[model samples]
Target: MAMRDASTQTEATGPLVQFARFDNGKLRLFSAHTHELRYFAISHVWGDIGWRKIPGIDGEFLVSAQKVDFIVNQLPDLVGDTPFWMDTLTVDQRNQAEVIATVQNIPAIFRDAGKTIAVRENDGFYACCADAIRDARSIEEFRNQMFEHCEIHKDHVQEETYLKRLWTLQEILLSDTVQFVAIRGGNMDPIRPFSRMISTIHPLEVLGASFFENISFDCVLVFSKAYVMQEVILRLPAPLRTRRDSIYNDLFPMVHAASNRRASKPRDYIFATMPQFPWYHYPKNAERMEFGDIFLDYWEQASKNGFLSACKMKASMIEPQVRRDLGKSWLPSEIQPEPACLGDFLKLLGGQLPGKSAHTGTNIHVTRPVCISPFEYDHPSDIIEFIARMTQRSHFRFCLSCSTGEIPKDQGLKNIPWENNLKDINMLDWLQDVLGQNQSVLPFDSQAGNEIFSNDMRSQGASQANHFHPDELEVARDYLYTIFFYKNANPTEDNAWWPGVRDSLCRLFEIAPASHRLLPILLLMTATICCGMPVSATAWLMRFFIPIHVQFGEISHIGLLARHENLQGHPTPRTMLCVGQHLPVAPLLAGEGLHETFFPIPRRHDPKRNVCFGQELVLIDPEDRAPIGLLPDILHADMDEHELWTNIKILYDEIAEDGIRIVPLSDL
Candidate 1:
């Protein structure tokens, strides 16, 4: 999946059927039924392709010249409270709403009357936006309105991290020569900064490996109509509260109380936020899942949409036992926790396995605990590598500059790459340069540890590094180290950004092009497990078994089936015909389609001893028809004990009828 920012997200997939900028001046809605891409813009003004001034969408406009407030009024009543406003708007309304919103809320500082804005950055646009904000009432509100607007704008573009924008905070994101043009006046790039100093609006992105559940950021400042650049400057290194007021020491209670309110209906607007799912488990994406289990993370966004009332109570819905075992006690209350039953866990496992039953099966089956684990929340190595790169940027230090409350004092302008503070000039872990009067930067690519120690006695300039620049090796190392150290650095399981991370990983990355993303979901963490041998090998073989072998396919040992007598929970049943409620796993192991019972290799040989190669095969899905060729031999296809195991390969190909592709588990 791609790293989705707010701008490119508004691009309609398939064919954009309809579009319009509403009189409310803040909404644009569109939908592609086939693609299920319903969009809504809710900020100043959306910037995208239009399909004429369609009728009907010209509904009653509300609010004022301020597009976000106006669009807010235009929406069908009662939806503003939902996590994403799209839940309330109609399909057509959503699309048009998106376009209008994106175009409108563009910061006044970045608005260029008629100048051409490069897709990357244009100075003219920011000037116009800066002028508009001079009279704006609440800076926070303006920032919120703008961010909410852009979130809809770039919800779907795949190459999300390195986004291709339509306008900049100071100019149009597109160039005047081609794809885009100025809306109001002549095309000319602006060469000025915003007239007014716009206060930064650093919104929080949940931390998760999945799509929406945890993709939320610590804080990202709105940079353009559809993009939010990570803020690298802050007044304090702590969580800040709302800037609108000066009351209260900790605003936790206020924020919590505000969070209680919620929308009562389903969302109609569909942007890039889609629920993620495991690929292999989901039939729609089965083929691609061969690489790894698909992670359905779109739920991250849903969860972030302000739906949780009581997480403890909610967990009970899935497994009340979990709640009983784990629940906080408040006041003098005594909700004595219930002891977990080992037997119950066993039964749950057995139910899914073969040769187990409520009447006869006596073993207790337990799976990996349902609670989230450290690995689940840990950022994978791939994304860590990216962090290493991002930290080396001349702008790298600012990436982590964020405050939930007020902005911090600027750390004066200096030039010795800020990878390290300016205490010592030549130590990787030590300060590289002091904060005095040096403006030279070394943007070379190498290990931070190696380069910091040996500086070429010859240099004088600014360090110009991109995301891949190793000058900030310390950045990746420290960022990843911080994540490892911080208990809750990841927002997945605790319900911060799990839904977003899950959905994005499954839909945008896993099921689709594998690495559509530059970094893991939360700065660095993979949501979906790609189904393939290389990754698995790198994990199990390189890390566990063989240290020398780094080859991809050479590590096909991951999919091998062990004699897991407890596959589901109990032993494989030799004969379900004799018993009543045959366990689900018993038949599943009877080769491919075991549900329908159309084909059975072995009817009832022995129910006591473990069932293996000689065991019968039963096909359940295809009208009780038996599988053709060597399916019976395939399931019972053991290598060590059976003599034909050696010659089985030759016979498998010549199975009388059709030619089939067969490879050993080692070859897979």
Candidate 2:
């Protein structure tokens, strides 16, 4: 597509060609909290470095109140005589002022248009370009969008001066080439996880916060020559700017703060606005407090989620320039500024994802499917599920969002509960208990109102689980399905739900998978009535599926690590000595399954110094401990793998030998 400038009269009146541009090495373009779209130092070269119309994904920088303050602080000391301030587009987008000026020079485009040119201004100037634009939508549309743009950023970018200033920044600070710090899973020093959302990662956000505690940068800001007199794109009411030259008034750092310091150019600039306060804001020496385990603090549960590569960051860089040249391009910016609206949030949530949501009927107070005896929840997802199935005729299902560490491993079978806590747990035990007498609880709920399924309803020849006791039903429910838990070599950086722990849900509940793309359908109903297709459903589709749906709010469950993912890499699948995440994490033909891996943490003496391969699963129960071997045919090790297996085998042998010597029935 050919690019267009402001001066070019639209042969066919429509949107102008103000392309999105990027100069900084950034992962994504983000609208700044300030009026101007903020640009960040992407810090790396990228391949797909360009722009797209997508919101939030377009830019790298965020003009927080701080960055804005910092920029103003860097301005030269002479403020009164400064004609005007120009914030130029730094990326290659609008570096060609001549091109912008030529295109913007539309003398006859507007019926009353005189001339349009790029210019900058200082505080002494008149009613200025209170707003800017890369392209004019409609004269009216352009003006309105500029209003909302100004409202959100509190500063404008589409102004000619803004583009000019940005261009200056590129000439001064930015380089055509820079190096990006790379991320490799285990190879990068000590591999640790990162977590967020729960405010557990404040220390990580302060990558350089403390570096500024006792020290400041010896700084210099290179400025470009100023220009004057060009018609401003948008106008505002009394309090806002009034003339073209007045636009420059925005250059000096003046903040709407408690102190309200109106410094056009301060001797030593600090910040425009403060960030969200951390848990520890101030204390005697908190600035010097030790950062205990950075990895543990910021670790996201292991999942190989997706992200834009370095090149993509580069592509997104072009956006700011587009915004700068186009000057407040949005027709109705006030309509959508952020993710406060559901659709807006979903837009940022990527695409039509496959998800599930819980049904109000999937209630805690509701009775459970009765369970038969001699059985227990065999795995983490089973405890309450057994109860939910008693009155039902189909296999139930549920979804959960959790960490890799939350899935359970069977040591020797007494139905060991994984790390999932009771508050984080939900079960169908009540239904199972009620059905224990081999009688239907449906009879008691005569007022359930719905006669068809409410009664002891079933197909004539169907084999219902009614014959089973609550305990037996419990065992069947637990064993029928098992989870497959594996760790991601790299964690998902885009999702906020990770770094989570275990949460088990009925497979049919449909609530948890609300994010998944699956939709509830009329066909799901037909099948349930005719062919009996297990009534398979997720948490999301269930609520609306029921008529006159009553909302039961939501069950609050503790977000825990779902399961420990072993991302290091797994050998090609073969039946040699592999441990799959299931009821029996690793079986031994009824032999032995180890408990956990323990190392000599004390550097040969400190028990704490030992890591479990630094993992917990390496340790095995004394009864289940035994050295198992993998066939050589399916094995391919590049020395590192061999050494790992060898060390693991040694631990297994030693633990087995020692455990057998002292393990008791209670230990199992």
Candidate 3:
């Protein structure tokens, strides 16, 4: 066969390779710039890098020998003598300019092809599924058959290397029609209409049930689902494809879909995603841009468009080393954005307006430093220790005052009566009150009528019968007291509930604390609050005691704080506090108020320095009333901390008329 390449006039008129018949039964290629040519495009994984000579009409050309042999042998059984353009043969790999030019025209190439054939070597499981689906009458019956026979071939499908290549995503997406050819035993097993298989095999259905009892099968299910979603999203119209309401919403699934896929170059990970992001512009010198520079540009663009409005100055918890290596303070090398529930916290603080806007290119300004605290902790463990000491001291006093004895017996603590005479007798409301007055309480009806003795059953839809039994209240109250008073017992040793409570505390801190560090902190914080310390003071201690310096367009200091202690670290916590602005909302909700963001604070090698980048909490100046806007400064190691503190004290003194008192650390 002789092949021709289309001329490079434009992407539409760009070169297409044509294959022609040859007397010697070898392929020959020639360049042609015409719209009338019809060809199928082959999409396959490059299994081996080694090259071998493939016979052409004029001569022989070096190509991935294994890939060429596999495709040539399978072609007759797969597509049946249809001429096609395989990238390996069509694109000159040795010519850099040709590769770049051809890559830019890839979308057009795939879209113009008559059909896209995805070639994969058949493994036992895929073969079995294909065989079973041919005879099955319904999806449910097919699923049943798959479940029965899947175990034998499950490993092959889960570990399929073909699905884990990045370029294959674009190839699969751009094609109008795709057919799968599973090659096995010199025979091509045709899986017609690729979308049909995707629609039938749902990851949740296959992986959710533990019927398989295999971890690898579960993994396969997850990856397959991601692959399906990635392809489906790409097939949507361009306008609907990448235009998302928020960056957080769009970036997660996009990154997740491509997570396990390998790219030849690290920058290709970001570049491949560009086709999906219509709004994003590649740098004019994209070919020369460093991988880190690409990420930095992405962060800048996202910030200018208001994507980083809610981002706090926390270092990457999982990939701290990656962030450090990138040497960009504003960009997180790890792509996981803060969760959406953080926005709920912003609403509570009256910080952000509800709903997303297409145009949120607000100019955020970080103003002068308010108060930089002299107080600093060396590690999260140090803060945990401080909380534990405070808790133990408070618990000892409570136990000493108990009427039963110096320390209340377990039975006595369990028997503590619910004060029925209280004016507000609603169990839910009372529980909220006990937890913290700042905590939001779900309404009785909102709690599925869990209220044991509420006469108000109107919200229950005329069903007083559905109310909880009156006896349940006594049990509920006893359980609540046990949890509340468990602080007096030695929490570190033998308490079952303490571990759960500690895990909750670790979550509250946002950053993952070292192992065995959080339980004591939770116990202590609870004990101190129960011992009559103001909830606000305890909250400030946990959230706003440590200062974090943030830089994006400008450098500024922000303090981490939470409004409600009880709900502080719930996975989707109600709110997070930005002390610099005195803003309390979820981390995701900080977009409007947050102007300057900082990442990768100077790395602290000395444990005794008591300086950490992503600490859980920080202290905010009580009187720093700087208007919310962007500020300018780069936080360097040599920066004057003394001057920063001086500015903070000035701000504190200026608000003397407001009667706000700065609580000293020693007082706590």
The lDDT for every candidate, in the order shown, is: 0.22, 0.20, 0.36
lDDT of model number 1? 0.22
Model 1 TM-score, all chains together: 0.20
| Candidate 2 lDDT for residue 533 | 13
Error of 1 at 323 (Å): 4.3
TM-score of each model, paired residue for residue: 0.20, 0.17, 0.42
Model 3 quality (TM-score): 0.42
Sliding window of 10 residues with minimal summed lDDT for model 1: 542-551
Q: Write the per-residue lDDT of candidate 3 for residues 30-91, one digit (tens) a residue.
A: 55542456667777777546555654323333455555566456554554544567766666
Better of 2 and 3 by TM-score: 3
RMSD each, Å: 25.5, 26.9, 22.3
TM-score of 2: 0.17
Error of 1 at 569 (Å): 36
**Candidate 2, after superposition: displacement of residue 467 in Å?**
29
